[model samples]
Target: MVMSLALISSCQWKKKSSKAMRRRRGGAPEIHLDLLIEILTRLPGRSLMRFKCVSKLWFSLIRSRCFSNHYLTVASPPRPPRRLYMSLVDHLECNSMAVCYNPRESALLLFTSSSSSSNNATSFDQDLTLPGMGGRNMKLLRGLILYIVCRRACIYNPTTRQSVTLPAVKSNIFAQEDYRKSVLYFFGHDPVLDQYKVVCIIVVSSKKIKRITSEHWVFVLEPGGSWKRIELDQPHIPTRLGLCINGVIYYLASTCMSDDIIVSFDVRSEEFKMIQGPPLVSAFKPIDFIEYGGKPSVFDHTRLRRKGLVELWVLEDAGEWSRKSLVLQPCQMHLVNKYTKWKVKGTTHNGEIIFAPLLLCSPYYILLYDVQKNDLRKVRIRGIPKHWFRKPDTNLFFYFEFMDDSESIMHLEI
Candidate 1:
């Protein structure tokens, strides 16, 4: 009986050894390319980026534009996952005077969090850090974040940790005249043409005539990208950052006659349309122009903490306006401090408007208000460096955006 058991064990060992030898000798079972691609599309972007080194074929596949688009479609669902992107800058205090001491030493951290619902508490994971960039006024569109670094436009891909800097706009007016000039960049994606473009506006104001002259330039985000000049009949001063929705870039602007208007730019057609701005939206300097329920909506929360009610204006159609008032619950009113200033960062995919503090504090937290249910809650932000809170003389300046999870492995050029 013992000799029989020994023989059986030897046979089993030899069978397993033979299978291993076959795998080592390139006799492993083959998987179809399509099947492999399908399996890879379901993985997270970080994993797929690391898998690029598995083989030459994988490197090409993972980096291809086709694969990137497919992966985006697979990863993006109807509701999509929610992520928060933050750009923070620290200023040092010298003898009670606050100043940006060192741009190189300042930290620009991007944090990402995944949550199924907007009400649940979400924890952030520190994803990427760019030292000295000092990103300002960041705009996110289709998995790419556009920001300004020293007045130069930069597009960053968080998934692949890659960034591309666009050429600065050359202003002939600034070189020749003594006019005060400012440059602003707006990023948008054309769904019809499937292209990303940056709109650069240079506004030159002459005190002599009290006139403002503006020039518009467009640059597509592709290989060999160059700025092309576009003409506009009226020169308007942009008052806030551009909000792009459905291939249209919208922003509040003031005409040369001091009339406030909403300027809409078509990303694909490269055309500009002027719409008369609503009174409340134009009068408020810190008003938030956000996308609410798939339309361009103006969110006025200035009297939220004081009166416990907020006003929302939606652009129903061409030049048509609709307004609604949302009153917060009496129970949740404690979360808001009547003295502290709060700004509407953006909206979640579920249509909940997110409000964040304008001033930075040690334990940072954001509030979410559900217009439909009249519910409000706060979510605490974590993962900030302890030293930031420890230093009493440092002032933190930051901008945050809550967006759908749209990670991509796409490569950037030009």
Candidate 2:
């Protein structure tokens, strides 16, 4: 009986393996294992996920770490999966999102991990209403987003439609000191360790005592993750979301609130360092922190008379920075004159700067400036739900644009 069962199992395994391999005949009629992997790696993200059911051998190969790395490299050979999401907020705090990827509609977002869910291809533009996630402080790294809050954190991966809400972080030893106030959270990843980390900086200020204290805590994402507190001596309070590169996190911070300094934190070492900001900085002027050509760069709009020019400062090393100036052409300046409250929205990995306006009207368009060619082009985002702008001036709207190009399949592991 045991021998018969063993033979049956062996036959089943052979049958599965045979279906997975496509025997190709050449001059030598060689088995195309490398060719098979090459073809599989070039397939679309969803197509590869669906092809796993072809056989047990195929399923294992698709899910293996080796195959995952190869597929990721192929997908992002030169250009990664670039996705854009635009969020608009009105006077009454009502928010709407513009997704820029779904076919015949806006982009994709807000997925759920339902066992019976066959609706993998979801659309967020169909509905003008936004998610219940409160607060404006958020970070988008790869396809995952962390809505930073000391009280509650919403960590979500839109690619796999998986989400986990982390518990509220403990603020300080004193019960009266509310850690939620002035809470700044930065989401970063250590590519070397393949880990996602959330750095929380909570500023607990007391008016009666005339003093302020800062607390730092970190949360690393894993199967079972928890928050660990770190000792901090620096008095910097970061003002914006950090840009994580390699294993370092860089964000704009301020010690006196009059001038801003760059804060660098190593995610792997859990150490903090400060870099001095450029001179002649003002809050009224349009300044933005962007990743330019794989390094931390700043975009400053140096306004002169009715015309303005943007300066791109790229860091060559820790001590040196290269700066480039951008001025709009005659026709591009004409379009810019009509826009109000426009600012540098984002910068792509290929050094294309995006401009978005926070106007209270429709038929909105964004500007894209190429650094290499020194040319600017405007692209209008269409497919917004009709009901959002149909109300006319009854509702005021302001838009913020974000792009994610870090395409990785690790999110689907859950």
Candidate 3:
């Protein structure tokens, strides 16, 4: 009887194994190219990039013009209401948390507590950790984060846990001393060419008033090949690196002690040309680059007798830089004065310009300036001691970088 039971179990196991093999042979259902693209479009950018390696059909589909147009159309729709976060250092230096908030939610609550004297500090959310982040200059480009650490750069998609490290750049071309000089890094995606480009500026510093040197590097993210660095005639050192609007990277350069010049880099042709800025006002603060109304815009600040005012400029014509609209309004100087010196920290998704007031201020407050409607709001985290922004305990220093979600995906797509 025992032998009979054992034989019966063995036969059952063999039958199960045979069924598994049959299923394996049957394989997954064949998905048509259009159907595959529809499903692929639903997946995040990083997943599509990985799917390229799955099969030659997938590679052709993803790299096709129709796929790119559809991807951009679906991925970059009308801006959703977003929440911004800034990291706060806890007792452990390495362990930090971030506070975030959705401005739309805040607006709903504002009407209920309309008479409240408190400056709507409750809009800010609780703490979140800065996980999987290494020291780097990060930029948000089209729903992905681009992080640059040392000589290496990567595109990280936090939502999908997908990251692609770019190939190491050739360090031998630039001298060690030249590398130490102030350099501007800009990352962007050009759908026209279906490629990603990382632009690096190597500026020559001089203590003398009239002396200047121009040195720079351009690295293209080619398909299959590693990042190829292209040498170019050096333009002036750009004060601020702009985003890619229509296949070009715009930069604001200080032409003279008093003049500011807008320069642009063509990703396809690898050329540099100058654009126009706003009309000059006495004591004009340099314009900060931002994305507004689906195009590249600039935020210019001017203080009239300690009262701060700001203006937004949008590019009306790609060929004619002079064609721009200036929208102006008074700025909240109280919020601006919280930091030691106010600089355009960065721009946010909701057409708000974030200003980092103090260079050394810790537990920093992100000042949000709405260029379209002329409004100012401050985002500060709770439970943070005021002393964090005070002078450091020692002479130690720390650097802060803001990473965007869009640019991160573009790297992996490259």
Candidate 4:
């Protein structure tokens, strides 16, 4: 509806601007370029994409990087009626959970819910389907989603329904039959360059665990893009999914000397730096990365269900961390069940932490905990596919992600 109004307004403005130009001596445009851009920015992506055919000028303007940045800046603010984006990959059989689930066999469902004025109920509607099994390892940034499909790194734009599969990185570790090898891929966008990049790390180790070697590769997402080898001085094993804040990609890794370390890579500079991680870092810890108050934070809810204790670790500087502990209030303690495992999915614009169950079930609901008010409430999600819950004995696993903003209309290059 907003797009329709914007289109109507544009048509009316053009007629008035043309007459004013004729009356002027120099035939100058009555509408300033900035004003035109402001009107176009208000329209959603689908309408703007269709409007590109109206004229060459409109096509070029909408495709420019400067315009994309301007549109993002205008649309990124936290307004009311925020949305929650979720992706679920369901494995129906118990045997599928024991092994690597094939993307062809499983179902990947997308959903979105808008927050009501009362913040009481949220109803999700099914979204576009993609060719991948999204899980906890998947990462969503800006208007794109990054996931692995058949061992290939894939970046998908939900707005455009466009996907780009990155070229495979060549490594000798894959051919080494006697040695164990693992690969990790991270997705990030460079704000300065206005480009998307994928970072690949391959770690190879033997049974002795004495020697470890790794390789790093980087790929820029654009036309005629290819993977290039990069260098890192110290070899470490990445333990978790990468989190990109601003233009830096951060993830947990362990070196030969210490088990807790944070490796940060600058997307624009392509430089790697290591920071001393918090003392609570561990391979088995139940923690998630989130943007809290415009800074990178580690949400540690390992004991939230078991003991009702939650820890927030904020990165203050290079190697400094500020920690705060919050325990669940006695009255709201009933909301948590010790038997049901929960994970910190993400945060709302108002700084509320959303908690989701690890196991999938019918009548899906999520918990919202406001740090400021020290309150907890459950918001039930309606409109999940009925077929998913038809068979009670069927095993299912779900992967969910949330963004506390509206849909992005940014066009992707690849």
> Which candidate comes out best when scored by lDDT?
1
The deviation in Å at residue 406 for candidate 2 is 5.7
The C-alpha RMSD in Å for every predicted model, in order, reads 7.9, 9.1, 11.4, 4.8
lDDT of 2 by residue, 192-215 (tens): 776778887867555432455678
Off by over 4 Å in 2: 1-37, 52-66, 76-81, 88-138, 148-151, 173-180, 205-212, 282-284, 302-305, 390-406, 412-414
**Model 1 C-alpha lDDT per residue in residues 90-181, reported as the tens digit of each score:** 65322211233565666475565555224555555644345655366778887888877555688888778888889877667556364566
lDDT of each: 0.74, 0.58, 0.50, 0.70
Looking at model 1, the pairs that clash are none
Per-model TM-score versus the true fold: 0.83, 0.72, 0.63, 0.82
TM-score result, candidate 1: 0.83
lDDT of 3 at 414: 49
Ranking by TM-score: 1, 4, 2, 3
List the candidate numbers ranked by lDDT, top first. Answer: 1, 4, 2, 3
Q: Residue 233 lDDT in model 3?
A: 49
Candidate 4 residue pairs in clash (backbone atoms < 3 Å): none
Clashes of 2: 3
Candidate 1 local Cα displacement, residue 316, angstroms? 1.7
